[model samples]
Target: MEEIFAICDDITILRDGQWVDTRPLEGLTMDSIISMMVGRELTQRFPEKSNVPKETILEVQHLTALNQPSIQDVSFELKAGEILGVAGLVGSKRTDIVETIFGVRERSEGKILLNGKEMRNRDAHEAINNGFALVTEERRSTGIYGNLDITFNSLVANVEEYKTKSGLLSNKKMKSDTQWVIDSMSVKTPGHETAIGSLSGGNQQKVIIGRWLLTQPEILMLDEPTRGIDVGAKFEIYQLILELAKKNKGIIIISSEMPELLGITDRILVMSNGRAAGVVETKNTTQTEILELASRYL
Candidate 1:
């Protein structure tokens, strides 16, 4: 979440039951909100991702989800190291599109090709096994094991990878892998044994992303990665996304925020009512143009 700044002839900030600061909106950016309000310096800016897409790694053709006719005739291609953004209004079936591609929502008619080979993923496990990972939009309700500790939550997605030939889990490998994610993702907690529910929303999100990364996915789909977090955490998540792209992974992000999607993605797939309205290059497109296409089918 960003700090709410009001603009008129002057800008005003309301914080802690009092008006904190008021200034002209001139020369202001969303980036400065953290320091002006929280009294902490944001040390790192988000890294830039390259726009030149590589080989096409995933293709969805004329896809339709079972029992969900709203997702009709959806098609797109994602290249290695490219960040694709999906945007639409509420009830636009944005979530349904990603879930169908990741195999959580059944596909009634469509073809999913990974490296030119057709994949029929009947369930989430099959998707994971096919080198795909999905970080669902709803974290507390559907993504995480709230009562479980950080270790369990972090390693749960790749549990099968740590199983021995005898079919027993290797706790040592699990803890080691979990530590790597904590260090890599910078997930803050008192200890890895701490309950996931005890952490703040941002850290919880980091843990959720870490869990999906453990699956060693070639395609990573994130639905609203920064929904309820502060701006600082959002920057961190953006950096993580760039880092993933640096590894040549295909990243598909479904976000409601136009700026966030336009800022980070290479190309955007604007959905309207339930169909693919347009796919625009992020570098050349404006929010006005995106919104126009987003409302086409509505």
Candidate 2:
């Protein structure tokens, strides 16, 4: 927005694939722009968080990735109904923590405990079966099958659930689940048969998130969940996260955005050069303290 206001002479607003208006950028405020983009007055930038932290549900102890220059001795506990934010600088290897736990990245040394039992998530399939889900940082590259339609993308994560007695995928069940993803996530698409790649970044992200939700994961990890999304879409995603947290789902969000972490999370685990620098209560810690912790290992 700062960049848009500084240099762009004219601004065009698009809502649900239709052009709302195009005019000079001179008189537009951030709120006005958001209003036009979402087709409504967005009363709040972030929803009022109502999730209360509960008993510890996931524990990562001495979690060190096998890959060099990655997370080391990163220990944290995620409670049911808690949003735990991971904050760090560019090279802090913040994403590595979730990837290792998700089993996409190998773990050299660590113990992952869920409900007081050790979970050996040796691969992505094992991780999913163990009630863990991850929304990777790069949606274009690692998140979605761009060429596939919404139905395929939506049911792909938990496709086994749609298998019939005859060893064939049930199109009826698949359609129902796809519709659920579209409706629950508020994904704007022409139809379930539309290629997921053709949708806007925000809509695509919504579908990806919705896809993960079908698995009914105990612990949900998101890496830069709203990186390329608009403010309106970002707000929607925030609400979804909070709603999940309210349902007692443990959420771990890794973000480079300080305000995002501060705004939504109950607590934050600061990362410093691939290490757990410190954990702070969001209400008590300022960006200054987080930055200080981020620079600790440097």
Best by lDDT: 2
Query: In angstroms, how far off is 50's CA in candidate 2?
Result: 0.5
lDDT of each: 0.86, 0.94
Residues 250-293, candidate 1, lDDT per residue (tens digit)? Answer: 99999999989878999999999889999999989999999899
Query: How many clashes would you count in candidate 2?
Result: 0
Clash count, one per candidate: 1, 0
- Across 233-274, the per-residue lDDT of candidate 2 in tens digits comes to 999999999999999999999999999999999999999999
- What number of backbone clashes does candidate 1 have, counting pairs of residues 3 or more apart or in separate chains? 1
Cα error of candidate 1 at position 83, Å = 0.2
